[model samples]
Target: MAADDERGRGVLTAADRAYLRGDSEYGSVQAERNARARIRDRIYDALRDFELLVEGLDDRDLDLVFEKRVGEDDGTEAFDALVSTLAFLYRGVGRTDLDFETVLREGVNLAEASEDRGATVDFDVTYHALDADHLLSKLDDDESLSLTEIAYLYESADVTPDELAAYFEDARAPDIEDGRVQSNVTDY
Candidate 1:
């Protein structure tokens, strides 16, 4: 809940962090890059197996289903991140012979309308990108919080990440001159 609690934390291992942090004078970053590249390749391979189901679908069927799942699940921040990323991918799929742009345009319209009205999506557990793993660990330490409870919290909360980001949009990490992260989570 506090800003100091979340920054500089990650779900990644120290080696991975260091590699992404890019002090590769000794080729550590390169190694990390290679590791990520391998993972990407593997993901591609896996998708190839499911290509028939996953590929060449538009928002009407594919993207709509994805959004429906996200909307149904509510404010699952991390999973939402994944879904958001996937939605972005879906957005990139251009019109095809079988699918037109109408689905994507309509989907975007729906999302914009929902967000404009401040429609709440509940999350049972949620975290900002920089602090997700650390936040999860912290939540784990709470006697009252289980993975299920945390997940519930993520799913139950009505707050959207866009709202969270907007609350802190004007404040940079380096600009904090006082206690806590230099962002107001409560601001309109």
Candidate 2:
């Protein structure tokens, strides 16, 4: 009777039910979903941070940098070299679609316009946001992102793995039903 009581008590738990059905794969699925969510959040946060940093730059500063001649006679090279380097780094990370030169040209134009009008220009972060959104969408679609790409995205966004770990430290395990898991993120 004691053994029967113990068995009954164990059977009442969800873990016991899953164990009984040999459905360990659901745990893996839940883990994968959580990891994807963390990566998505990191990417979003990084893009926002970059946007704020760019927006806060003074127009006067941009004008000075734009006017500064590098290597004796570069002919108004406003961040062209820096942009090219960044573009190269992004390409190394699998972002083949980004043309840093185009972004630099547009930024220089805006800076020039702002300087001419004696007004601060707002930096446009639409492209960066779109890129981050695309990455999130790819994650949602179960597309396999390369490790190098992931590393670069995190580095560009200035998101640290420690930060992500801290953010999800208090997260609870998701509930599973019929091999489908309901996230704990929505529970709050």
Candidate 3:
């Protein structure tokens, strides 16, 4: 009897053509494809729940607040601004035991790393602080976010409100030679 021509069907489909060309056996190809499909299905299922949870949240619930110091004479003013932004974001939502300074340091490190990789990072910091109890209660009841997920959300909020507002405004404004906002002087 002629061997069944399984080409164009099952694991012998073009999807596994490359692997098969590399001398992979038919059984192995089938196993790999099945495993990949299973993994993909699991991820889709997980994302469905995540999407539902996010859909339930109000826009205001996501807002956060941060402080910005302007016109400081200190040389470290810029550095302080960045740290304060990060600290404010991590406050309340972040681990209570973790030192605020540590979170700030990590934010600086992450920002530097992002810059080194030639990636642009844009963040918006909320004016509202994180409510740990509220977050925990939601998580407990909804199971939408894991502890790790919640922690990261709080961690990434490390930007100041003023800086965030400025960043957005700068993004929308037209480019100029000095990159400073144009102001008009009027005599009273």
Candidate 4:
């Protein structure tokens, strides 16, 4: 009876459950932080597993797998974004598909959900190979980088137009369309 009472005491009461469910501001913060941590951990695990699976596949097979898995509408947006980012990261040694952009976009989406949510995932370092040369060449070839991409590079990667210009000749800032400033683009 004593052991049983102790075990019951350890169990969460209704009020405890409600607190964990985020009934207060502090509870809400804690809950969101914990949830984001879980999601980030799952994303890392998924990426690691995906990397192992793709290691044995040729480019063609990898593309097929990526297309099939990411196209599944049953997945949440975050899941699709995670898989697509992994696919883009694996798409080349020196050649990367622009699909990696989804990771940062997803990060911003999460941040939009809660400002604190963005702090949980560091999207910049994941694609360290996506240097100024690649981005500049893409821009030169008439591909456009979104404002989110620019702000992410600027804020997280410390990549400014001047820095890129030092790497690639004639690198110029992408023109901001319609003079609209993104919340993240402070210097614009």
For TM-score, the strongest prediction is: 1
The lDDT per prediction is: 0.44, 0.45, 0.42, 0.48
Candidate 3's displacement at residue 16, Å, is 19
In terms of lDDT, model 1 sits at: 0.44
Order of quality (lDDT): 4, 2, 1, 3
**What is the per-residue lDDT of model 3 for residues 71-113, given as tens digits with 9 covering 90 to 100?**
3423244444455454545664364776555555655565465
TM-score of each: 0.26, 0.24, 0.18, 0.25
Q: Positional deviation of 9 in candidate 2, in angstroms?
A: 43
Reference-based lDDT, residue 147, model 1: 35
TM-score of 1: 0.26
**lDDT by residue for model 4 over 1-188, one digit each (tens)?**
22223333223434343445565343487776875566557556765775465345566775565676445533444353575455545563235455444655764565455434444444454443545566666666867665445544544354564554343344344632222223323222
Candidate 2's error at 35, in angstroms?
1.7
RMSD of 1: 16.4
Residue 130's C-alpha lDDT in candidate 3? 55
Task: Note each model's CA RMSD in angstroms.
Answer: 16.4, 23.0, 23.1, 18.0
Per candidate, the number of residue pairs that clash is: 17, 0, 6, 0
- TM-score, structure 2 vs. true: 0.24
| Residue 173, model 3: Cα distance from true site in angstroms | 50
Give a tens-digit lDDT track for model 1, residues 154-181.
3334533333233344744333323222
Candidate 4: misplaced stretches above 4 Å?
1-27, 56-63, 66-188
